[model samples]
Target: MTNKLKLYFKAAQSAKIGIWEINLETNLIYWDSVTRCIHEVSEEFIPTTKNTIDFYSIDKNRDEIELLIERAIVEGTPFNKTFQITTAKNNIKYVEGICQIEFLNKKPIRLLGTFQDITKEQNLINELQQSVEKFSSIFSSANDAIFIIDISNGIITNCNPRASELTEYDNSELVGIHNSELFPVKYRKEVRVFLKSHLTKDNYIVNETYIKTKSGLTIPVEVASGKKFKVGDQTFSVCFFRDISERRNVEENMNMLSLAASETTDTIVIANPKGKAVWANNAYLKLTGFNLQEILGEKAGYLSKGPETDKRTTDKIRKAIQDKQSIKVTILNYNKQKEKYWFELNITPIFDNNNNCINFVGVGRDVTARKEKEFELRGLLEVTSHQNNKLFNFAHIVSHNIRSHASNLSMVVDVIENTENTAEKLSYFELFKEGTEKLSETIEYLNEIITIQKNTNIEKKEIRLKDEIEKTKYALSLSIKESQISIIDTIPEDLTVCVIPAYLDSILLNLFTNAIKYRHPERKAILKIGYEIDESYTIITFKDNGLGIDLEKNGHKIFGMYKTFHGNDDARGIGLFITKNQLEAMDGKIEVESKVGMGSIFKIYLNEK
Candidate 1:
């Protein structure tokens, strides 16, 4: 190869340009090194006239190229066009093809073409076109009226469809109009000077103004914001205008109260300095279900006070009136028909020129629904708290009480199995049966307690307190014997307490077990059970000579879950917590008094106050 030819090929390769030829008579196709690389074909792959055209995409590009080749061969025509092709690697590319015919004796024999990869340039052009189309769509379809104004002269150079609709002007008329021409005559001068201030910087602060339509109707508008745009040396401002006519009407209505008297919905009353009713608004009359004649001369709140009204609240209002000062209170009141409602009242004092109190005004509204919902929410929270405590209590009962019963049954069964005599074995079998029955009863009672927790309500029965105590004593007879604890019951036989039977049983059992579990090692443990009747409660006391808890240190946490004092190995610390929750579930509570060495006196108050 010649040096000049090598230089020419190198230049072509640098520009990604390649050369190709098609010979018509010989049915041969030739591709240079750069051309073959552009087609992504292997070096050893031979090119034939039939297979060469297949490199062009199997779409319009392939058909168009075939047509161009035939024209060049028949009429010696030349063509320059861009074609899309799929390379041997199946990657799509765009190529620019410039071809002309090579003639032999005035007839076409071969066609020569330059193929250059133009994919990157074509992709860039496509992206730029898409960006332009996107911005054009946003400008035309914007919700707010858009204006492009000459910042120097304040002339509206361009506008959107929305701008024409807002100003009631055609697109051509709106384009060349000055910005001030769109505003009312009174505001035009101000609007003109305001627009002219955008000489160096765009002012984007929203300014409120009125726009004059074609028919001279003034509509409210806000020049929402603006951005600076530049084309060559000239600068323009892109402004957005929003119609605020509805908003203006709303603001005006809020500013002015119609007649300012009957417009308000809250009850209003004017009373004399002595707090006697003098005048009342229609809302007050409607709320109380009384006419003006019936309400006049009556004390301001006399009509609403009922049998259930709180005297403390009434006294508070009376003191406020006597002092001639303003007061706000939410008081329970009744309508004329005796229906209950919660009144949120605000009282104000009016004084004369001499500063002596002359009149009083009371503004109130029925907040019964809101107050009731608040009360209901409080009750729900309490119920949730109770259910949560019961969940803990249920787990303790399952682990401790059920295990105790199971242990008794296992011991009784082993005794029955090991006994040699038939009668003794029979007696042990009966004891075993009793233990099994007790275990089953414990499970049923636990299930009942859980069901009551879910229901949030429990039914009480009149049961003899002495009988419940005796039953608990019998259940814990073995523990009492092992601990050498003496039991003394002072509750009378006929004294009955209104309580849930299962809860009473559980409460008594927990007290009995606690006395045995925490018995003093030095002194003889004695559990003295006593009760007293009061006007509001049936107080029951369970005093035990046991390892008493330190009230100063552990008083607050004695009834808390998982809290143990005195550090006994078997002190699970769950009995007292469960006992407290069970009592609370039944509208009762437990209190304790104790010293470090002395015994603990647990007083169970078992009635509602």
Candidate 2:
């Protein structure tokens, strides 16, 4: 009874209608509380087999119930059925009866059964069936060709209406065809291998290949295929095919344009409508001294513009791009090393069929050499004019100086010829000889100047400044001692600079002589030699504490030939002039700083290694 009650409770949770038991041998019967409740009987009411059979409708329902019970009891078979029954209140209710027989010694002895209400379960099953039918309808109506293939045999098991339309075949004709028949002959084997390899794995694989239509025309397609599921012994894959002929055509045109741009000498850059670089070729990278990684996705102008860039040209370029017009301009551009170059740029806006700008293409050629040549020509013209004036003045000065010496000799000759006393005649003869010697010296100085001016080729070699300074000091030792001068050399022992050795020696010798010649009368002179170097030039400085010249009065004339500021007869005013010429011939320069009584400093700049 406890087990029977547990069974009744389990069935009640699932909306079971009733539970019953019958003894076949003695014709005894039992009914659980659920069976009594289904009949609407009182708790204490006794039940009999006759009244229970009478509860069912007195028609085919009653006969069926009697037959199902007899089959269970006599044949030991289980039976389950649902029928309408009238309760004690005369209300009809649908209830299920399930019966199983128990046998003792191979003969049926008792039967037990359970009845459950399945109305809700039946309603859910009906709704699910309807949803499946709706999903099938939608799948067939899709626009793109869809093919469902059996993975193992590569056969097309099913396909939608669009598949037939795309392949130009009837739906019934495409159903049993192998999937390989859809692909072009060249790719059929590859398609077969792909399907077989990936059929077991749950993955979506896509490929762009050709497909053959019904009329034997090949069409390019992009197919997305993957394993959909496995049912029983068959594995299935669903593939979606899209036409890509238009995309292929666009790619071909792009390839042709790229080829043309690459073969040209000029650098070509392609920018989007917003003026940002999207692509550049090898020529572009080579021209700008930059790599693709450095320039891509950057503003087109940023790669080549700097502080020296012309703002007017940049504004013009911006306006031209905004107006979708072509522009040609020559602009100064800087490379990675910050070296400037002139570039001639031609930018043209590319438009689509609708007349809307899609991109801006620029072609640039480096024109630095041509621009430099133009400037060089203008500079040469100015230099030629200055040189002509200098030559005219030089010739006049030479003539005047020679004529003055000639006139002196003439006066001396007259004196010697007219005089009667022997001693007086001898003095006049001596005067004549001195004038001739002065004239010869002047001619020699003029020849030396011409030689310096004409000789432009000077071979340069590394010379140690400290060694040269010591050598100059030794060469001028006698003069230095006579003037009572002190020498201090502060140049490094290894401080070497590239210069013409003879020119360097001559320059230093002149500086030493000048320092000694112009020594202060009150104190002994002090000469200091030092060397310094900067990025492009090596500087050697010669400083002296002596009777320094007044730079404000004679600075410009200090290096001029035959220009003298001193009252001494030995001051020929030629040493500094020759020194300046030597410095210039060796591609060097000299600067002087001097005060009236303090000292003079001459800085000689030479090209650094």
Candidate 3:
């Protein structure tokens, strides 16, 4: 190659582009050294017109490039095209060429063009275009309201269809409006402060606030705002907003329902199917002495009967809950202090949407007084029946014993009148006298029982518990010392009892004497007396470690008159019967827990003054 041609090739290589030209008349082609290099061809190779045309990519592109070249040559037109070309190594390369028709004497004869390798630039442009198209599609089709605002002027430059619908404005009306205008007047300052803080810190802001519609009504909106930049060196703020009015309304309704539930009078408790408490009203807390935090997720059976309650009643309650049915029953429940009281539970099963049992809703009311009244009436009837039976038996005994004595006396008188034997008459008179004494003793015992029955109407007054215990101890000081019995009076001095003073004394005396009389043979007698004051009742317990009765065998007859446990000559069994009557007269109660060879505890619950 000549030096000029070599310099020209070096210049084209330095430019990183190829140079090519076509001769229209002979259909010949010329390629520069850089062009040969781009096609992976030798510098000495002769490029034929057909071979060069074949270098263009096959199919429509090759045909199109040929037509463009022919048109430029024949009509003196310029042509520019970007098309793929196949090199000598069969590798595809992208090239952009600009061609100008060269004219000689007003007739197109030659074509001059410069071709450049732009594969990298074209690929980058294609990828960027795809990304822009994807983002544009997402921005227009998103369900949530979207807005692009000019940060400097606070003007909304663009908005989605959802944004227009949410603000109750058309696209034209919202495009140039200030973002603060979309918010209520009260929230404008807050919005400004938020924007300022977000811009200063370059942080994203997400919050719930009220927005004003075109009709001036406020609607709840959740907004997410952040900064964005466009290709034109324009900075904008992007906001995503969603309506939350329905969610807020639902929360308000739930709060209202909770408030109403709290104000109810009946004790209401809701438990899941697993028997864990889920919700408990205020009345329930007050009735059960449990707070919401203490009872939530706790088993409902925690409120069941304690040691003093009847097992049968508790069993019935469990069965009712298991059956998922409404139950109205009275049960004895212990309060926080372990004091027993009666309550009427009305339990109903609550079902879920599937019509399956989901929970139990129980409403309860304290019925201690009503239960006490019922027990009192039953006791009265039992007492009347016992009295009637005793009277019938007494009549029969009275007739037999009195008539036998009287007949003997009458016979003695007859014999004294008929016979003159002084010694025999005196002996007969002595026998008659003995019989009359026996009858008088029988009549006295009957009168004592009648007196006890008549004293049921004795008036009651407030009496200090400690004073009564002291006085009773003083009265039995000798017996207590002789028996070596230890009396532990744990009862508080402040505790008082509402009872008939005389009856209180009589009841305590009987209990004390019995404890001493029934002292166990194996050990020294230990007596414990204590009292507890509850909301509506005062309970006094008298416990003794003495000869405890066999409650399993003799529990029912322990309080019956003439029933005796020990074979002692003084075991008349009338003391407890009379003591129970006295306590009953004052609307009080007595309960006993005992085990053979173990011990005995007597609990007396009375009304609080």
Candidate 4:
């Protein structure tokens, strides 16, 4: 071989691209350097027709390449192909081969071809194609409806199976149709305006709109639209739509049910899980004297009087909402007018699809009239019991007073009849006269109780609470000092209570004496007087750090006649009962809370005038 040919061969071997030539007349072939290397042949190996054919891939590839080569040589055709080739090393490689027939005067002379390895490039292209196919499949198979629309005409160009099913139309029927056709006539114009705004603004938006189906039924639909670029010069809009008809129907049904419940005398309110009112029915508005718009978004406790309402009832409501359960409670509620009323509230927690608490629904009914009847019955029973107790006590007093006087008279008369001395008779008669006077005083005391029952109304006037406390303290200075008591006046100077002067003085005097008499021996007594003014009433709290009474055991009889907690000889037991009656006569009330060792607090609620 010449030096130039040897250099060409060396260069071709380094290039790794196969080079070949074929004689058109004899159908003989030749392979240079890399071609021989591809066949795994030694430099000295002879190039032959059979060996070259063995390098072509087996089966169809080999036959296909052979036919192309024959056509290039016989018909002066040019051929280019990429095919798999198996080498002697048992390795497969992808190769691209191109051949052109050299022609002179329309007759073929020889064929020239080149082969290059394209395995890596072809494999990369195949992988990328597979990834695209996978993504396309997922997009088309998703449950949510998807659509591609023409922005200019609002025509639906493409849609997935879900979209077709949702609209009740096949792809052939829906394609090329105006998007406005899917909306009801009333909403079609609105939909057009929305689309125009979205397209003009080039902004993505999520919205809910009504869609009319092929069956002529309107349904709620949620749509998300964005701009997507196509290969064309103009941009196309892509919109994703989902049928939310079922969800909307459920919500409407719930609202209807709530309205139905509210129409009855029962009040109904729906609140979010945080206990904020979301919806208040008409009945609830009427019962609370608050409009739905005013109460919505406010806390559920906004209608409650914090001091009068039972804290445990509020706590139970919170717990039920947190635990996603139902709770029923009877609680005191105040209306917009600040009038106190009682209600039986049934609260139920509403849950979402995931079993999480989403909201709370409360159904309530006013039990104020029923509670008032109960209170009246209780008052009647108390009055009857008091009357029975008064009668029994009166019997003892009558026997003690009347019998003593009568017996004295009888003894004096007998002494006068049997005695000879006038002076002894006159002394006995004076004693009998004194006994008659005592009897008259006892009869007057009984008449006082009857007068209280018949006429309880008393004129009221505004009296300063602090001044009343100070006056009572001054009046009982000696008793207060003897008890070693400390008085803390937390009541505001301007705080005033409405009561008659005489009744107020009597009430204060009775409470002061009781406090001093029951002062705990182990510690100095501390009395706290405070007052709070509410919208409709003034509450005065008189708390004493003294020996407290057992409320549970003695609360029923605490304000009854002849009921006494302390065993003091001076405790007439009628003081508290009379004080309570006096306060009641002026349309006021008293409530007490106490612990055996902690202390006792008495709250007086009087109407604000």
Candidate 5:
């Protein structure tokens, strides 16, 4: 081939175009290497007129191209057209065909054309058309009022049908109006500022404002201004407007309710479903003496608890909140001043549309005076019960001790009378003196117990448990050392218990002395002291490796007045009884485990159950 022919071939290849020719007179066809490659056929394969037409993917394309080629051959016409062709590999492609008829002596001799692959260009054009159609559909059918604005002039260049409905204006009238005209007079300036700030941004800007309709009514609206872009040298912004009048009305109602709550004297608190406080009314803030910052994010009922708050009441409130239920409780609470108050509270759960707990509302009022009166009456009742118990003990002592003393005196007098001896009579007087002295001591002990039990208004003071234990150990240092006993103090240093100080001291002294007095003779004594705390009580254990009581026989009588298990001469048997009574007086409890030879374990409940 000449250099010129090679240059033309190179140009066609660069353009992705192939050359083809057909001899009309001979009905033969020629395909260049590029054309053969386009058909996905081997270079050695030759094509003919009949076989070439088979490459047309559809009958319409085959007939259209055939007509074009016939017209070109018969009338010496030229044509350019785009059609689909299936290659030898059965793959479809769009190709542009340009053909020109070559003439010999005014009769058509051949047909030549360039076939260019236009598949990529056709695909791009189809995609662009689809995007435009989708955008048009959304713009015309959207629920929100849509508007296109000319950014340079703030004019409403175009708007959806919904915009006309929202403004109660004709479409023709709305297209030329200033964008700010849609907003009320009071909000137009602000809307303009929002629009200016938004149009330069890369994202949509949202805000709340009021719009003025053609009917002269102002309605609340939430608007979002879409990003701005240039179209045909004019920068435009698309904006959405939504009617929010109903939402505004709901918000206004909520504000009115809030105002009412803030003014009420009853305490009101609002918390999340998790029990964390979100808001508290003025009365609640005054009652707790906590600022918003101090309580926000904290559990609603937690801040007012103190040394005297009943754990049962608090637990009831907590479980109610966790279960998404409502509860009513009258509980004692302490303010920031550590001053006591009684609150009658009602907590209700707020649920969402899905039946899920979204918030909790608590309302309460101070009932301190009524509560104080009730406590006084309850205290009196408790005192009377203790007095009755004391009277029962007194009666038992009288029946058991006084009768024995009376019978012994009678026997002694009889002895004196029968003997008729002055020395014998004088000795009998000594026995009388001993009997009367024993009765007097019993009366004194009973009087002491009566006084202790009658003080029903015993104030419980918070005391560090480990410190009190150490103090008791120090007071009994000599006895502990003499007993040669091992002491294991395992109570945590920071543990605290609230109880009457004197009662606590007495109970500790009794337990310690009792342990030392009953030490086993055959083995070294070991006392392990430790404690465990639960939701409402602290259990302290005193485990002793010593002579254990026979619980099977003496268990019922262990804590009874004047009851003794072992035959120790000095065992008055009142220590355990007094210990039990002291614990009861302070709303505490005690339990014991013992065996004949193993050891003893005493578990004392330091706080109320």
Candidate 6:
């Protein structure tokens, strides 16, 4: 071979192109050094036509190359094709085969071709195709609006489906349109300037702007833009935008609700169904004298109930909340200063769409003054009812006692008129006189009762209960001596009770007289008097070992007028009644305990004036 020809052949081999030939007559193949290297065979190895064909892929590759060679030989035509082959070492590669047939006398004998390794080029093409497919997938499925723009002209090259959706435009209409078409008129100039500055830096840039939809409605949006890449002389950028109208609206509504809650005057609390407070408004803090930090996650009732709070009302509130029902109650509560107050509380159960109790809303108003007024009104009503009953009893006494006395006097006077004997007439006149005297006594008793019912200003004075007992014992000394009663005064000398002087004297005198009058016939009468102070009240007690009355049968009537028990000869049932009236008139109370045979105790509670 010539040197230049050898140099040319060496250059082709350096380029990784291998020359191959087949001799039809010998049915053999010839391969250059490059060909043997390409096949990964031994350097000195000679190959047969069949083995050389096996170097191609098993089925389609081998058959196609063989048919191409046959056509080049038989038709005397040249052909070039790219096909795959598996080398002797099991490495698969793509190679281009260009074949030509050499003929003598127009009869085909030899085929020649060159095999070039095109594996790297084919791999790069495959990688580019995969990258395109990945880009296509992401562009179509992104949630945010995406745009590909030519930075030089501000023209849109492509837009994703989401971009079209946000702009209310079709995908076909969006492509090839200027980016300014999507921007509001006022923002178009700013957007252009922003794009220009950002393209130079090629760094990510985020800006907020308003966009005009296809229907011309302006919507706020956030744009995240950056230069994605450069292709040849063209610089491309990508922008992602999302509409922020809904998020802004939510923030605005939340601000308004927070403002209202902070400024409302009613005490409000939001709590879980377990009664733990989740939120408390400013009014709640003022009402309860506690801050939100102190009460949060604590039981709502912790601040609402104190020593004087009604337990029954608290239990009802809890049950109502647990059952997801609304309840309204007025209960006494205390503040940080430990002052008593009343509140009208309204608790409403808050439920979700699933009908599950999620929380409770409690609203409270201060009703302390109103409650106090109601208490006073109730006391007045009770006093009026008591007075009415007393008046009715007075009428009954007038109709029964006074009429009987008057009828007796008229009958006696008629007898006096019909009698002829002076003794009988004088006896009738005496009967008339006795009936008038009894009538006068009844009238005087009625007058005393009427006086007791009137709201007179009785002056109160600090008087020793023991001194009062001594005075009463002196006044009833004759009765006491006649009954041979024993008096025992256990009252403390220093203990003083506030009472009207006359009422106190009358009360003690009546008690001593009753004890002597009702003395047991079997035992000597003994009276024990005692006094003590309990909180704001001074208690005076009179206990006597006497003919005890049965309280079970006559307890309600013990203090009633004209009501008698034990059928005692001197039992007018008026002294005890009058005694009760005087004590109550001085804003004091009287109670009694007695048994048929065991004796009786009368207890009086007087205020400390």
* Per-residue lDDT of 25 in model 1: 85
- TM-score against truth, every candidate: 0.53, 0.36, 0.43, 0.40, 0.48, 0.44
Give all candidate RMSDs, comma-separated.
Answer: 22.0, 19.0, 19.4, 16.2, 11.7, 18.4
Tens digit per residue, CA lDDT, model 1, 1-609: 799977977898888799888888897888888888889998888998667788887789999999988888888999999988989998988899989788889999888888999999988888999999998899899988999988767788998899988989998999887887888789987776666664445667678899999988899998865768789998888888999986687456434532464657999887888999977778888998988888889999899999988999999999999999999999999999998999999999987558988678898999999999999999999888877767776777788778767766776667677888999888666556666777787888878776776677666788888877876665665566668889998888899888877667667777888888888889999999888878878999999888888898999999988899988887778788878887887778899998777789999988843
User: Residue by residue across 1-609, what tens digits does model 4's lDDT show?
Assistant: 799966865676677778788886786778876776766677776666677778776789889888997787677789899888887787787788888778878988988877778879888888999998996896699777888887666788888888788889998888889888888899888777787888778878888888888898788998888866665765678787888876787588777987687667788888888889988777778888888778888887576654689888888877877777898998999988888889899988877678877678898989999999999999888777655544544454444334534544565567678988888777666655654554464467446544543432334678787887886675455457667888887877787777755456656766776677787888889988877888877887889988899988999999998888878885667767766765665567789898887678888778766
Candidate 3, 1-609: lDDT as tens digits: 799967876787799778787887897889887778878899987888788888887788899888987788667879888888888999888888889777889998888777888878888888999998998899888877999988888899999999878889998999998899999899989888887887787668788888999988899998888766664777788889999886687457546756877888877777887667888888778877767898899876476459877788767767877887778877888766677788788888876557788678777878889999999999898778656644543443344334534544565577778878888778666645654664464466445545644543434678789988886675555467779999999877777788755456656767887788888989989999987778867888889988889988999998887788988885667767766765665677788998777678888778654
Residue-wise C-alpha lDDT for candidate 6, range 6-116, written one tens digit per residue: 896798898988988888778788889888887889977879867888888778988897887778767887889888889899999888888878798898788877888
Best by TM-score: 1
Candidate 6 to truth, TM: 0.44
Better of 1 and 6 by lDDT: 1
Q: Which of the two candidates, 1 or 5, achieves a greater lDDT against the reference?
A: 1
Whose lDDT is greatest here? Answer: 1
Show where candidate 3 strays beyond 4 Å: 1-8, 36-63, 85-92, 230-233, 253-609
Error of 5 at 99 (Å): 3.8
Query: For residues 8-31, could you state the per-residue lDDT of candidate 2 as single tens digits?
Result: 567664674567778887787777
lDDT of 5 by residue, 1-609 (tens): 799978998999887789998888788888888888888899888897678889995689999989988789778899999999999999888888999888888888988888888889988888999999998899889989999999889899999889988899988999998988888788888998898788656588899998899999888899998878898899999999999876676467557868989999999998888999988898998998888888999998788999989999999999999999999999999888889899999999987567988678899999999988998999888778876755654454445445534554566667778887788789767766655664464456456555655554545778898887776665455457768988888988888888766556556766776788788999998888988889878888999988899988989899988887767885777777767876776678889999876789998887743
Native-referenced Cα lDDT, model 5:
0.82
Indicate whether candidate 1 or candidate 3 has the larger TM-score: 1
Instruction: Evaluate residue 546 in candidate 1 and report its C-alpha lDDT on the 0 to 100 scale.
Output: 87
lDDT score for residue 158 of model 2: 85
Q: Is candidate 1 or candidate 3 better by lDDT?
A: 1
Question: Model 5, residue 310: what's the lDDT?
Answer: 100
